[model samples]
Target chain A: MQVNKSDLLRRLKKIEGQVRGVQKMIEEDRYCMDILVQLAAIKSATHNIGLAILEGHTKRCVSNAIRSGDGEQAINEMMEVLRSFVK
Target chain B: MQVNKSDLLRRLKKIEGQVRGVQKMIEEDRYCMDILVQLAAIKSATHNIGLAILEGHTKRCVSNAIRSGDGEQAINEMMEVLRSFVK
Candidate 1:
């Protein structure tokens, strides 16, 4: 929540574009391998975006919460989300 | 390419919607960890879709290629895409 988010938004836009590209590939009946490659790319793109969010949030939000003596709740919330990430 | 594609197309549409949902969350200034969770979900969704495509392609396309004595190329292509998937 504390990170600069405009860049993240832009990444999301690119990911949306990738998704649309895959749809086009499907419609045109492109090779399955080609479509699979694009899908993998989308997965990795989302992974990187999530990593960026986690790093920015940790460096800013988590640290600030700890300094303010509110670290427990922040940490708990982060862990839950982290669990979801691994799932 | 040999997979039943209508279901895959439906899955893609859902993924596109999910991407749009993430964009909305970003625009609304949602929590960073929450956004991270959504991104992780998107990654997994893509993974499942990729798996579906691979399974279908292998059972149909790969077998047909082998029967037609054209398997080496199809297999090599599938390997390349699988490598990309792991990346």
Candidate 2:
């Protein structure tokens, strides 16, 4: 499951803009509730982008590794990422 | 500015368990791609938790600072976090 690189990048760029907007809202003394709403939106966008990448990894990298008998190592690598990701 | 502490904790705990599960999958030599899928799920959960916290901060902490004319300081704190977050 290879990722659609362009689509992922576009989503990431949109999230980046949203983050900047949150910062600007704070600087402008925007309403607290509004800022919070923006933050939530950004978070949701980020999660979506991560899911896209993860989907690709599962479809392509992981499957390839399993077929090549490198499944254990691939799993270990993913585990390492998950440790930091959750942290 | 106050978070629903219980909800945040519940989400974090779930993600923690997911991370542990990913590790176990690796230990058990579960399917490589399946492990990757699980890892992605953990990442998504962790992001949601982070968003919850960030929302609380914006609603409570940032607003409070603005009312007290500490808006600059509060914005700076958030910026610092964004720096690391986007990195």
Best by DockQ: 1
Name model 2 segments beyond 4 Å from true: A1-87, B1-3
Query: lDDT per residue, candidate 2, B3-87, as tens digits?
Result: 4554544554555455456445545556544654664565465455555656667788888899999999998877666554444
* Chain B TM-score of candidate number 2: 0.89
Candidate 2, after superposition: displacement of residue B71 in Å?
0.3
**TM-score per model over all chains:** 0.89, 0.51
| lDDT digits (tens) for residues A1-87 of candidate 1 | 435677888888999999999999989989888899899989999988888788888898999999999999999998889888867
Q: lDDT of each prediction vs. the true structure?
A: 0.87, 0.59
Model 2 RMSD in angstroms: 12.6
Clashing pairs in 1: none
Largest lDDT belongs to which candidate? 1
Worst 10 residues of 2 chain A by lDDT: A1-10
